[model samples]
Target: MTSAHPTASRQRASAPHAKEHHMRKTVRTSIAAAAAAALLALTACGSSTDSSAPAADGPYTAPAKDITATISVSNWGDPGDKAVYDGVAKRFKEKYPNVTVNNNFTPITTWTEYVNKLVTQAAAGQAPDVINIATEGVELGMSNELFTPLDGFLKNDPEAASLRKDIDPKLLEGFSKDGSTYLMPNTFNTMVIYYNTKMFKAAGIERPSDDWTWDDFLAIAKKLTTGSGANKVYGFAMPYYSFGITPWLYSNGTSMMSADLQTAQLTDPKVKETLGWVRDLVTEHGVSPQPKGADPYQLFPAGKAAMTGAGHFVTGGFAKAGFSDYDILPWPKGTTKSTVFGAGAFAISKTSENPALSWEFIKMLTDQQTQKQWADAGAAVPSTKTAASTPEFLASPKHADEFYNSLSYAKPVAAPRAYNVLDPAFMRAMDEIMSGQDIGSSLEKAEKDVEEALQQ
Candidate 1:
């Protein structure tokens, strides 16, 4: 419930994005004008001929020292995020002293908004040389032709092999489409249940265990719910977002969509049953807060709630709220102990003026040292296996290893090209169900809507 640094793909619709929308519109116009002038210049010089030659297929060797060009990088503009990327830039500069790196901190709150802005920039031929894209936007970004394929660079560079060996292969595979990779996995996060230890002890209930069942979780939740109305302390807070909801679906051996990402599966028996169970937590048991837009991060750490689903990104926020007695447990089992997981990747733009240099910068960003720095800062779970196991990442949270272990059972978010439309529609259905609507009817309507959207 604490609002620490935001994690990759962990977007809340409640977060503001209106200001960013207007800003992007303004920037888009200017970028369009500049692009027009550049096109004219190229036409005048007779340099606008087709240059779609295939990239060389082999291991890429780093240039000795002749590279010198400014490269632009874009990422979410959070307060702490700049510091993390600044560290990466400094190290990148150490290797290429003359190459200037410009960081474009886009002030967007959600992956959807970020991808929308990137699409606008790309349309204007002004996308950054390198971009930090979250898993939710990877498919969309690739479909827009905004990113250069990284497979050629990966196959040609020996260092790329070592880098691949360090990072999680599943993370890499998630960003690939049709056997071509468009991004290098940088950091990842997985869903987990964070419980208020103080509240559990006060309620005379034992803390959750790794293999606890959903029935056990609900029982504990009922015991932990106390007080009344405005002064009430709830047992659990259900996140209305997909990151939280998908874990329940996965644990029950179902998903919001088919594994092929081509069909909506909200009407599946297991999915509907899972939704009904979650709805019961709010209506029948009265152990969860009603979806009235209260921030769970603030509520949980304030001891207004006993448990909530979250990722490691909340750790910093919990520390800031002066609530340090909390501990994490794998989400209670349903049919299986599964969780939703996502990762962030650094992708090169197809219009990059210096693809080789951009690739080099990406290499530095995902290297073992940079991954360790990010982990030590508690920014995100390192994508690299070596960095993930290092002392820096394992120091604070006694059970931090659970995050890594959960990856074995974790499912990549389903991101079909229609995700931009499908996600919001599904979220609406979930909200309706949680608000006391009939689950069967709501899910049926949601399924039709998603199927229609996917066809468009």
Candidate 2:
């Protein structure tokens, strides 16, 4: 969700070269115009009915299992995601034998592209009944009136209520707008330092603690780096994407926007310092590769770099490459131990013909048993603490718990209603800074760009 690139390991497998960024500038002008028109039309129609408003009169009763219905769901799919979905569907069939869920999965791509495609599809009357929305697209989806509120179901259904209690409230908060819930939080990810144990051992550097600081991390990176040119092994492969770099800014006690999501904070002194610090890792310290086109997910496991910033999803790639000598650590502290996190959700489309059936399916997706299966797959941290703490999840890479533990100090990735505009503006500034432009000037431009876009 923090990434425009699919966060699921399954989606990543099909698009290994895809940039792991948030929203990028991939929306076609025609489709973007349609999206704007759709939002404006919905707003003009006073479409914010009680279904999407705060009022929940009573429980939403799901239809009988014997009732037959076929509903299509949209998602980013690859072989792995297909397998998981098939498995879940099989189990879901045992209970609702007559209900059918047709998954419409698109290949992994930039979030802007996906959103534009959805806008085009909806215009053609081919939108799916349900959508697997990540944080990056949540606000856009909401602003476009793409989802129906689930407060009635969540507050009234016994099973859904149980799920609400089991999931972390913070994650629930991410999927909520105003006082209505539009989606159920499923799997999530948070940033952490993934280091190669063998490389650390070779450098004679002990593993950093959960409380390690920025200076300590820099020192270790310097020690681990060696050689030069083509044969050089960078100590770290700095991720240049929004999801990858946000943790650094977050750790430094700054972010791209204000908490209210109404203003840009990119020009904050702390933000400038953080960007400069990351730039120096490549330009001055020479411990990390240039962030412009870095691929830490591949570089870290290929043994080309000793460390990288990533989430649990990278573990799948590492396992496929037969690289297992790595462990995770909390992001090093700056003024605090803060880090960025993101979650995906199962959102029922406002245009769905069978809202009750969609609610039942969403409940199935959020079940603890389903979450445990997802945790065992090792892609993301399950939103439910019970599922995330499973032995199966903790079996690999010592300190796997750090992924879940970081939630204590982590903030949801910055995804405001204007994300489509905000993400690209911020990313452009980051790219300029990484390419050696002046940080202060770049951020000033980014701030101006973002604020102006928001006002429009």
Model 2 local distance difference test score: 0.71
**Deviation of model 1 at 177, angstroms:** 2.3
Question: Compared with the true structure, what per-residue lDDT tens digits does model 1 show for residues 151-262?
Answer: 7788778888889887777888888888888889777778889888888887777766788989999999998899997889998977556666778999899998898788
lDDT of 1: 0.69
Per-model C-alpha lDDT, please? 0.69, 0.71
What does the lDDT read for residue 206 in candidate 1?
Answer: 77
Candidate 2: which pairs clash? 4-21
**Span of 10 residues, lowest total lDDT, candidate 2:** 22-31
Backbone clash pairs for candidate 1 read: 1-296, 1-297, 1-298, 2-297, 58-156, 59-156, 60-156, 60-157
Q: Candidate 1: lDDT of 303? A: 82
* Cα displacement (Å) at residue 35, model 1: 19
